[model samples]
Target: MEGLKECVANLVVYLHPSKAKCPNEAILTELSSMLFTYNETFEGVVLAYDPGNCSNLAKILPGIHPYFGVKLTARILLFNPKPDMLLEGEVVKITPHSIHAVVLGFSAAVIADEDIRGEFKYKSKHGKEVYVSKSHKKHKIKVGTILRFVVKSFDEEILHLSGSLLADHSGCARWLDKNSDKWSQADRF
Candidate 1:
């Protein structure tokens, strides 16, 4: 019964069905618009939304009929990551030859030195040279500094990021709030 309730919580009602029709074309268009939004936004994923009670439906149509219940249907979207994909992440850690970053809720990334424009190399300690980027020297990635990288290889959920193409600051962009438009608020949080 608990599982059943969980499943019901995720359900959405599809407004339109095949062979369904309404007298008003305008109302039909609105329904179609809602349906199309669900289809495209989720890439065919099933979800739920609470549109206010259909009191308007009673007004538009000349009937005492009222919608007692609503049911929606949608398909699930699949996960698909592509090569050479550009993404922004945070500087989680820095190593001698590589930088580790976390992107899209996962980790184990190795950023190529050439791709990181913000990183500055410097030596530290008792003649034992230690290389650290600008952020690494501070021991923390500064807020608003969005690290950008290209997907060199993704295998078994591990991504190899390259900074080679980003060497000239040509690839890396500034703060995401002002510089980027690709990642939406929903995608970020």
Candidate 2:
């Protein structure tokens, strides 16, 4: 199924607060299913932010805002599917310095060593090969990995990267869409 994408102005997450009857597992499972469904049906782009979690909302929303393209707002509902399909334990955790978003079956790069003990190398955007510890190695990665990295530490230019490694030239953000007037404006100016 094709993924859904929509711009959201505000997302209101209803939490039970009391985890006695409605557990966090139930809540996260519902949320994940909803996100998957939304990602499959919507198009254009999607921007979601929860008002309840103000601090975290602030951090992620700003980072994703400029990439939404034309979408402005949207809403999605979440509900538990079944007992066996529930999400148990913490699915996402956010602290002052970092935010960790977890998925049950997340695939990431893993070492291909036969000895069961070795380091794995991952190439960063800067062309620097970084070695991951044996314990930190992953087997594969999902199409889009949830990174819990610090937003402040890295240089901002990395975020503006465009095009493939073969073509080191930039100014290709609107390359896929020839109808964009932004290109005309750039020519005129």
Candidate 3:
């Protein structure tokens, strides 16, 4: 949620000659192709889009196969994560060496052993594996838990993220919210 941003874009969509009869539909299909994929021009993954006004007049290219360009405006939502940014994700898997999570129900994230701070200890009880904070017993991270972590690196090609729980503000989101006062006090020292 922290990295989600919405912005307006003015774009020109080129439609093939066959789709000249239905230019609007062709434009919609072209915009749909951009969803859920990382675009360098946008600098993030496109989540959703709303196409705005379209010009009735189109410019047709003077080539063997005529292609027409339709100009339109659109609002798009993007997920752009940056280093040292705090993010929240749901834990999907856990191991002694790492924790796997999904951010915003789409992007994948992994918190490796070296990135986990010393305060949290990996434990197994009744066949369930979890990371429990030694400093605060109530703070725990297990499968299905919502975790807050700092972004170490992000792979745009695969939408994979490497995260860290080394910061005081990074941990179990529920625990952090419940103990906000106590957490702030700890941050002071």
- Residue 7's lDDT within candidate 2 is 40
lDDT of 1 by residue, 8-31 (tens): 123323233331354234333444
Summarize candidate 2's per-residue lDDT along 1-189 as a digit string, tens digits.
012222433333343334325434444443454442223233212223232222222111235232211111334432212211212111133222222333223211121223112232333445422323332343211223332111111112221111111111111122313334533554466
Q: RMSD in angstroms, candidate 1?
A: 14.4
Which stretch of 10 consecutive residues in model 2 shows the poorest summed lDDT?
Answer: 161-170
- Name the top TM-score candidate: 3
Query: Candidate 3, residues 1-189: lDDT per residue as tens digits?
Result: 578899999999999999988888999999999988999999999999999999998999889888989999999999999999899999999999999999988999999999999999999999899999998999999999999999999999999999999998889999999999877997899
Q: How much lDDT does candidate 2 score?
A: 0.26
Worst 10 residues of 1 by lDDT: 1-10
Task: Please report, as a residue range, the 10-residue window in candidate 3 with the lowest summed lDDT.
Answer: 1-10
Better of 2 and 3 by lDDT: 3
Question: Which candidate has the highest lDDT of all?
Answer: 3
TM-score of 1: 0.36
| Model 3 global lDDT (CA atoms, 0 to 1) | 0.94
TM-score of each: 0.36, 0.19, 0.97
Ranking of predictions according to TM-score: 3, 1, 2
